[model samples]
Target: MADGMLGYGTTVRIGRGATPTWTPLALLGDIEMPDEQADEVDVTHMQSPGRRKQFIAGLLDSGELSIPMNYIPGSASDTLCKAIKTSGEQVLVEITLPVPSGETAVPEVFSGFLKGYARTAPINDKMAATATFRLSEAVEP
Candidate 1:
């Protein structure tokens, strides 16, 4: 397997609202890729012989996209904080990442809604907010 370009894993950005024009959503720390699960069923038994069996094609459960960033008092990312702080309904947002070894401009879009948001003020560090978005649906037609 070929190793990827240096710093490629750090490529991440987000956009807000329907038909969001992309933006360079900054990050203050590591970005966690959405966690996935491969559920399995036990199917070893009687007729033949004792054997272990399970399916790797388990349903891919929905995931949470948590973004933690330094809070700029008036930065674009602030929208994320506002999203969770107060809301009338689900707010649509878009998370983008480059296709591995491919063009950075054309990203893979994981569009969904903001599940929740929270802010933190560490005594000795810059104010920050962790935006947790639940990826519930695909936007591509």
Candidate 2:
């Protein structure tokens, strides 16, 4: 296998409107990239010969992205996340993958709706939250 880039410098940004003005979120942890999947259709037939199951591809799912970050109430990131969830509006997400030296960066841009935002406060640990976004369309270059 070839050498792959590390996840040290990965960044996630969120924005709104037709011509979105991107702003990076002060993420505190790893970012889960979109996991694109396709649905399968099973077609079974009973013939004179042995029975077999046929399958075909159905609709494609762009998949969801889960991001973990520090929870700072009333902050811009927190407010934006809540607004998106409350309004049920689609927002733009830009994920820039880190590349090696002198290599062009790869960005995965897509439109998605904020699915969920949950915060946790532990006595021994810091306050953290997870934001989940459901992709509504194909990810662009």
Candidate 3:
């Protein structure tokens, strides 16, 4: 399912950290990036904190879920700058997952597994920089 079409009840797990592991719990269709207008703001600079907070707030507000920042990995500094340069006024967040062939419940299982992974996984500086979201339900379009 496409990220844009994900449902409100759908759960999402965003992969973050140095090891590319899942950490944050996110609702699939609930994620959003609200439009912001900042005069004289540099896209590169605005993309980091501004975009990150927008993403977090939108998802949390829509899904009514809370995710700890310590669990995610990946620095917003470089990534934000890169995203701004590439997308102009917008930032791109790419999500990839293994889609199960037969069972449609794979995404939900993945979400639960990710939550468990976050609970037991060790935190390191490298692993502390990424962002992850585990959604409430599997998205279906």
Candidate 4:
């Protein structure tokens, strides 16, 4: 991963016959983020399709996803923190994937995976905003 990406880890818990199962997963490595001034963070970079899918898969595989957003400690607030303090803030990201035929149900899988991941994942000061899925496209395979 690039220095611009953030590092994260996750744990998932599943319920079985009135019992819950727990699983954990961590980022393969640290991710890089776009350089910005102190207190000016950009959460948009974290919304890539590959990242999203990997997150979802992590959740499905372990029943939990943990994303560690990169942070710079300083006197100023970053774009990410600014957006977090303000409600109704939105960012756009584009993702491309090799279109899968048949009944892959990417969206459904993504939703379920996120829900499961979010249920157990923790958000801290390092996190600027929540992860959201935007678009998916099939590339020539």
- Taking all chains together, the TM-score of candidate 3 against the true structure is 0.20
Candidate 1 error regions (>4 Å):
1-4, 8-18, 21-24, 42-56, 88-106, 137-141
Give the poorly placed runs of model 3, Cα more than 4 Å off: 1-6, 24-31, 34-38, 41-141
Model 1 agreement with the true structure over 76-98: per-residue lDDT tens digits = 77864574346634444444444
Give lDDT per model, in order. 0.60, 0.84, 0.32, 0.25
Evaluate residue 113 in candidate 3 and report its C-alpha lDDT on the 0 to 100 scale.
18
Q: What tens-digit string does per-residue lDDT give for candidate 4 at 1-141?
A: 334422222121111122222222222123222222223233435666566433211111212222333333331223323332344322222112223335342211111122211112236534232222221221121
Q: Rank the candidates by lDDT, best first.
A: 2, 1, 3, 4
Ranking by TM-score: 2, 1, 3, 4
**Which lDDT tens digits does candidate 2 get at residues 18-131?**
778777777658887787788998876676236667778898899898889999888878988888899998888888888888899978888899999998889999899888
- What TM-scores do the predictions have? 0.63, 0.89, 0.20, 0.20
Residue-level lDDT tens digits of model 3 in 24-123: 3432222332223323423344557645433212222112122233333334432432333343331122334434447454332222112112222454
Worst lDDT run of 10 residues, candidate 3, spans: 110-119
Give stretches of model 4 more than 4 Å off. 1-67, 74-77, 95-141
- Give the C-alpha lDDT of model 1: 0.60
